[model samples]
Target: MLLICHAAYARDTSSDSILAGGTLKPTDAFDMGAGHVDPLRALDPGLVYDMGARDYVVFLCSLGYTQAQIKSMLLPSPGVDTSCGGDESDLDLNYPAITVSDLSGSTTIRRTLRNVGRIKNAVYFASVRSPQGVHAVVWPRLLLFSRRKERITYYVTMIPLKRSQGRYDFGEVVWCDGHHRVRTPLIVHVNTTMDGGSSSGSLGGLQVA
Candidate 1:
């Protein structure tokens, strides 16, 4: 077997996310909404740098799964666990020590992992602390199965804290290069308490499959 490593740019258009209805801050372009609350205020202003990081789609797309299907999986389920270590009262989080502008622009964000990424199971874990010192965690997964010529991407996200019910939104992973800058246009809107479970919006032509 040949172990060939390759990079690819895959376009996935997802069912519209309900978390899409929010205000995007102009200063750094962060999404703000009912669920997008911040609780990390005790830290020093120097540490205010720990606010959090998020990436919202600059555009929208019509793709895989109907709105109903997407809503079923993306929304919050009753039986799901909302706290780490099985305790919502005791929540702990380690925020990234960097800011959006600090990331390297030259580095490219990988959308898919060639053959393995498409076949194997994938998960996205997100956590945040608001200006009030409240912390929460979220786990989003992408399951994949192949059928003939078309490859489908699955999206499933879970929040692990009851307190975070309406204090967080989808966040984007970002990096910056020393010179020119490049980033994936896919932005996610994560809401734990929308009429539906959650919602998403996209920018550029980027869409989740």
Candidate 2:
């Protein structure tokens, strides 16, 4: 039996549906293509985003979880200490997706990628497509992975060029290493208001297909 644990969240369900062009329901979750399992291909996935226990603790801390609350969630393990001082930025969680909510203006998000390709040194190029009325910029357009599990960080900035109140825009940022295409979906919600008050905006999440 193959067991795959999927994280459950309100956004994951809805976002997966939007990406798949399916109904907005929990049952549509597998339509995103991440749930599909192939034993043969799994044997040699070129690259993967590796997350460790510390990464999760840091992610929880960034979500404003208290030390006590975070500690309570941890299972007993040897040589593992719960620390809450990791990067508090939501975008730095080492996740496969990128999501940003509550955007009033221009904002930048950071992401790190790990290289697990069979080749020792592989170069990946970055390409991005911005949604309507939005300008997206990526720094360090070229990434070179020298060793296995080598990680690199890149930043994406989304700037609102025009007012599109309560609009959901979809874009994509992809990394091509000739053979494998590592793609990350970029979702931006425009919440421009005349008085600059809080307004409804859509959230962004990561997707790999």
**Predicted structure 2: lDDT:** 0.63
Give lDDT tens digits, candidate 2, residues 1-209.
Answer: 12121112223434653333445444322245234444555554555667777777778888989778888898976555576775587666666555665556767787777666688698989899887666777777889888553888888877666566675666667787777766666767766642343222222443111
User: Candidate 2 regions off by >4 Å?
Assistant: 1-44, 193-209
Which residue ranges in model 1 land beyond 4 Å of their true spot?
1-110, 113-162, 184-209
**Local lDDT at 126 for model 1:** 26
Model 2: per-residue Cα lDDT at residue 176: 77
Looking at model 2, residue 68 earns an lDDT score of 82
State TM-scores per candidate.
0.19, 0.70
Instruction: Quantify how close model 1 is to the true structure by its C-alpha RMSD in Å.
Output: 20.3
How many clashing residue pairs, candidate 1? 43
